[model samples]
Target chain A: MTKMTMVEALNLAMRQEMEKDDRVIILGEDVGVDGGVFRVTDSLISTFGEQRVVDTPLAESGIIGTSIGMAVYGLRPVCEIQFSGFSYYIFHQLEAHAARLRHRSQGRFHVPLVVRTPCGGGVRALEHHSESREAYYAHTPGVKMVIPSGPRNARALLVSAIRDPDPVVFFEPKALYRAFREEVPEEEESMPLGQPQLVREGDDVTIISYGAMMVPVLEAADSLKEKDGIVAEIIDLLTISPLDDTLIASSVQKTGRAVVVHEAPRSFGPGAELVARLVEKSFYYLEAPVKRVTGYDIVYPLFAREKAYMPDTGKIVQAVKETLEV
Target chain B: MPRSEIELPYRIEYLSILDENGNLDKELEPDIPDDILVKLHREMLSGRRFDERMLNLQRQGRIGTFPPIKGQEASQLGAVATLKNSDWMVPAFREALAEFWRGKPRENFILFYGGYDEGGAVEEGRNDLPVAIPVGSQMLHAVGIGMGIQYRRKDDVVMTFFGDGATSEGDFHEALNFAGVFQAPVIFICQNNQWAISVPRSRQTHAKTLAQKALAHGLPGIQVDGNDVLAVYAAAREAVERARTGKGPTLIECFTYRMSLHTTADDPKKYRSEDEVKEWEKRDPIPRFQAYLTQKGLLTDEVVEQLEADIAQEIQGAIDRAEKLMAREVDPLDMFNHTFAELPPSLILQRQEAELDLSLRKEEDRHD
Candidate 1:
């Protein structure tokens, strides 16, 4: 076991997977000599040679579309879309081809491809770099969507994504890349794609969130306990599309009050889907209507306004207070 | 050494031999055995008859929708003739002729047209992909499969069929670009059938010809007279041979015309004049090929009658088989299935809800 940040864990997973399989290749902008702008692919090009670790021309569609071709041809391609916002250009290929190829071919072909992008708003990044639009992918059928909240899950889920016989969109929270360290197993240990993790146990209220929002949710839980004597249960929804609703419902039933959080706009956000599911399954157990703390439904603002745009500990605590009052 | 910066343009060619009178011009005859020529003519005739049956079925509401390939029979059959059973085929919507040659049962096509699975005719590892409907999506798959075959060091080649309208899509450009750079053993066969729904060939492109577009990708592009069966076969054969020998990819543009509406739902008369139809009718490939066979003393009236009778019986049998098969109850959860190897919890819950709804319906029926 080793203590590492989410970014470091991801880099280690890539290195480990590459060492195990020669068919694996990584391609993206700034992924090679620059070690990726986020350094998620640092030292990979040097260790694995340029052919396997390619720094491609700055074309998102080309990167993704060509990776599909490569994946079809037998290479397990791991493509990096510089940021989540830049991934929109390749959605046509992702939806029309990558997602449909296996079923269209009636299981004759499998695209064991993983597309990784840094998602969520925090750290005051530039425009288009801080948006969490993973809900769009979670809504798309045929592709698996996984968002790991910390280093340990990041390393495990990425390896699973690479080895899975389907296309997976692995969203790494940019804010949590270096947020904390945890002991990731040296041996290959993978978490299944569609399971949620119960991050903390409490009996009063359940706080369901994933990715960057996990930070504030935990912080809010700490504040609630220290100040208001409220024990807040936290559930990290690891996979958004193949949502671990079973775990969510169980957690909601235990707590009786649920608050869903994310760094995407409020309307039609992933949190909306979670809230709807909670209402459908645990409506009788709830003490209050489900609440959501999410980004505003507007264009991701400039850096200065990002703090206001994202959910924070104060907002989460307030939602908890309201739930307790109800 | 620094690479030189220079701009170069490539030219594409469209080839044909059948004259407007449906007579083969003597100069462009292929030197193949008489048996092969007869087989080619039979395939083209079968395609024409099958297409005519489908159009009628659609009109009678027996089939949901269909994209007819009436005037384009010669181009589709000729191009497919150059391929072996082991070679791969990627098709756009209007390649029913190619699908027939690929041994797709007529019933499967009817099932697909009757609002069954989108891939009713798709048989995996059988050298053909399902009909791609999003215009130009399959071209990339063709390139990718070709790359895979090359990586495995297989001798097989992949042929992708598209139309002139597909040239405008980004996937088409990206497929061609990747095929060029990777030197993949793939052939891009574009059947320029002169209309994408109501859009004319002129509206789709302005490069004087569609074949010339291949030059930009560093591949040879040839244009064949789509009405001339011999010309299409020869061009496709040459391209396939080049690919098999590791010479890289080729783009063949078969300039053809859609003699019928885009599909049964479309009304060509709304946009096109009858005069244009009459012009193409004069160059109908079936009669032209029949005339060639007769001039060569390879086809007789008795043989033609027997061929028609045999094909009509086969097509009717397929239709009967498709209609007789019990229709499975359409499961709502089937939409969730095949999305992934395992159902996600959210979809599993959605499926359970649907099951609950079905049980409620059953109880209501019992009470009624």
Candidate 2:
């Protein structure tokens, strides 16, 4: 086991996968000599050389369009959009071509590509850098969405994303890139996508969350247990698209109360889907209405008000407490 | 050599190896064999007949709305002739002639506009992407395939065909920029057919010519007489060789004209004058090539008669086979299966629901 941050673990995952599969290629802006804007792909160029690790021009649409072609042509390409907010430029390729290639071709073609981008805000970034646009990708059919909370899951999920037969958008939480280090099994451990992880089990209230919000949710769960003597179960949703709906529904059924946390806007975020799934599957089991601790529906502010906009431990604990009382 | 002074005057030259009356510029003509010329002429005639048959089919309410490729055969066949079987082709909607010349089955092309998924069911070992309906998007896909070739260290070039209107899309610029920067082994063939539906070419751009647009993107752009197969073939061959030999991408603008409606749904007569159509009809690619073949003693009335008979019989047989197989149309259930490599439980349930709906409808029909 090697103790590494999320960035290091992800880089190691890509290196291992590329070493194992010659067909695996990396293409994006500054992923070569520049090592990506966050250095997540740092030192990868020297190890893999220029052929495998490519630095493309500043054209997101072209990056995705070409990646789709490469994937259809039988190469496993992991394309980076630099930032999740910038992924809008590539949505046409993703939604129209990449997602529908197999369907349109009647299984004659499949694009086994992984689109990676840094998402969510906690490090106080400027405009278009810290937005959570997972809903836009997950809402589209044929493509899978995988988001990781910390170092270990990031490594494992990215490995699975590359291995997946369909195109996957792997959203990395920039906030947690270096927030903490954990003993991530470098090459030994791999996690299955589309399944939720039981972070901490409890009975009173089940809290479902993903991406950067998992950090604050876990804190609130611990604080709720220690201060209020309220046991709150935390479920980290690793994959957002093919959601582990059964797990969330069953946990909500048992606990009879729930709180969904996310940094995405509350209106149509993954929280809305989780809440609807709970109500749809185990409506009578719920003891109270589902509570949501999420970011405001306004544009994510700069550093000064970043914490205020994002869901924090204080807000998550209060939401959980209210749900528990009901 | 990459660096050059801009002091000298530059002009975008047009190449025409064969004139309107089938007279070849002896110095510029390629040394094409008689058998190859016969084959080229036969394919162009077949393409013309196919276009005519599709137009009739649409009028009879048999096939779906279709774009007529009356005068663009040589423009397509000449550029696509240089591609090997191992190379990748990303074609747009109006590129049936190119695909057919590249050895894609006429049946596949028919099934596609016939509104079926199997139309795009390019079999194993074929690297041709399906005819993209959206304008200009496939250009980027071509660049991507080029990058893949670069990665594999293969000397294969990827080619994508688009119309003049597609150059106005953002994808076109991005694709050109990426291809130029990465030195991707891609050939961009812009079939400048004069009209983008109702929009005239002049209204589309302020530039004097479409070929000059590639210069801004740092690619060698050439203009060829699209009506002259020999001229198009020469320019395309040179561009394909440049890409395959690692000289990077080239943009070849095939200057041609659309002699039919944009599609079965369009009425060209409403937007353009009959005089314009009459002018282009005189420059049709088929007669121009036939004239050249007749001059070289390569094509005679006997060969023409036999070739026309063979093409008509072959097309009639393919149509009969396609029409008879109408019952084997792609099932709607195919939507759920290929969406993902493995259907998640939710999708499986959705498929079951769809199946259930089908059964219930069948049951109701039984009562009737």
Candidate 3:
């Protein structure tokens, strides 16, 4: 096992997949010789050549539209949107064509494509670069949304996404890209999408979250255990769209209380869907109602107030306490 | 000093072989085999019959909606005739005739028009894209496919069909620009059928010709008399040859007219005058080609009659087959299945909810 960052894990997955399948190609703005804006695709251009790892002109719609054609023509394309906010420009191609091609084609054509973009706030980046809009994609049918919390999960989930027979939107939490490192297996291994991983086990209230928010949730769990003698179960719902309700239900059943957390706005966010599912499936097992600790429903604030805008250990611990009290 | 008024440089080439009276210009006649000529005429006539039958089917509410190619048969037949089975074709909405030439099943179009499914069947390796209705969107697909072929080291060329109105779209320019930079093997065939819905050709662009628009993209541009079957065929053949030999993409603009409404639902009378339609009718390609064939002693009156009967029967058989086909029940889970290769947990729950909703509806219906 070799220790790597989330970015390195992603790069390795892409390299391995491209080597395994000639049909697999990558396209995005600044993905070629420049690597990626965050260096996630560093050294890819030299390894695969420019034809396989393409640096397309800065047109989001053009990138996605062309990928559709390539996919239809028997090529597997993995496109990178420089930032999650920029991905909005190609929603017509993503929602209208990429998502519906198979069902509309009556299973005649399958779009084996992956669109990877860095999402979430707390990176102190410019406006439009920091936004968690996984809910928007999850709401739209015909796209699978995957958000990996750590290096090992990122490598496994991305490989699975690349080989999947349908279009996938892989959201890499920007804040976690270099914040943490872990030993990832050198050999190729894949984890099935739509399945949640139990990061830490405990008998007390469960701390359910994903993406960058996983860091704060884990820290909050530690705080609760060390200070208050509360052993919190931390569950990372890696794949957001096809949520692992079975895993969530089982955890909530054991703990008897749940606190969903995320960096996206509180109202109608990804966490809302999680809470709704928990309520419906594990309602009888719950000792208290599911509570969400999330960002406020407003535009991501300036750097001055960035700390307050994002979920933190304090907010998550408070939520856990509130849920436990009720 | 007064502001300088700079002149924009432009070059346009016109290719033709048929005169206005439907007589073959002796100097430019193609020495085609008799069997090939017969096949061309047969396909053109069949396309016309199919267009008419589809229009009737739409009116009878047997099919959904249709984009008819009533007057553009020769333009479509001529351009598509030059394509080998290995070459690729990307079509805009109005290229139903071209779709037929590309071997797209008539039943697929019928099912698409009937709103039963998204017209999906393009025989693998036949290199045909499904009908793109978003105006000029298919141009990009054509360029991308050409790029893919180039990467694979294949000698295949791609022919993309669009319209006069598509020239105004940014995608058209982007596609052309990419093709130029990559020196991709592609032939951009623009069927200038005059009107885009209610908008006229003049409104689409201020340029003297759509073909000349290709100059900015660093490619040769040629215009041909679309109603003259031989002229359209010759121009397309030249362009295809150029692309196949690695000379890069060419833009061939076929000057044609739209003889019918945009589709079965459109009212052309709201936009154009009867006199304009009458003027274009004088140059109708079907009768013109028929006259030329008769003059050459290649097509007897008996042969024409038999050809018409044969095409009519073939169309009727297609209609019967489409009608007899069983409609598949809509699967709600299908909506979730293709979105990702693996089902996400949230989607699985949503699918369960949808199934529960369907069961509830069935239970209510039983009570009613």
| Pairs in clash, predicted candidate 2 | none
Q: Please report how far candidate 2 places residue A198 from its true position, in Å.
A: 43
For model 3, residues A62-97, the per-residue Cα lDDT tens digits are 778899989988999999987898788678899999
Q: Which docking class does model 1 fall in?
A: incorrect
Model 1: lDDT equals 0.82
Q: Give the Å error, residue B223, model 3.
A: 1.0
Q: How well does candidate 1 match the true structure in TM-score terms? A: 0.56
- lDDT by residue (B302-367, candidate 1, tens digit) is 999999999899889978877664254545334344546777676566456445544554564697
Q: After superposition, how far is residue A174 of candidate 2 from its true place, in Å?
A: 42
lDDT (tens digit, per residue) of candidate 2 on A165-258: 9999999999999999999985556899899988888899899999988888888878788888998888999999988788888788889999
Report RMSD (Å) for each prediction in the order shown: 18.7, 19.8, 19.8
Q: Which 10 residues in a row give candidate 2 chain B its minimum summed lDDT?
A: B329-338
- The true-versus-predicted C-alpha distance at residue B288 of model 1, in Å, is 0.2
Individual DockQ of the candidates?
A: 0.02, 0.02, 0.02
Ten contiguous residues minimizing lDDT sum, candidate 1 chain A: A300-309
Kindly report the docking quality category of candidate 3: incorrect
Candidate number that wins on TM-score, 2 or 3: 2
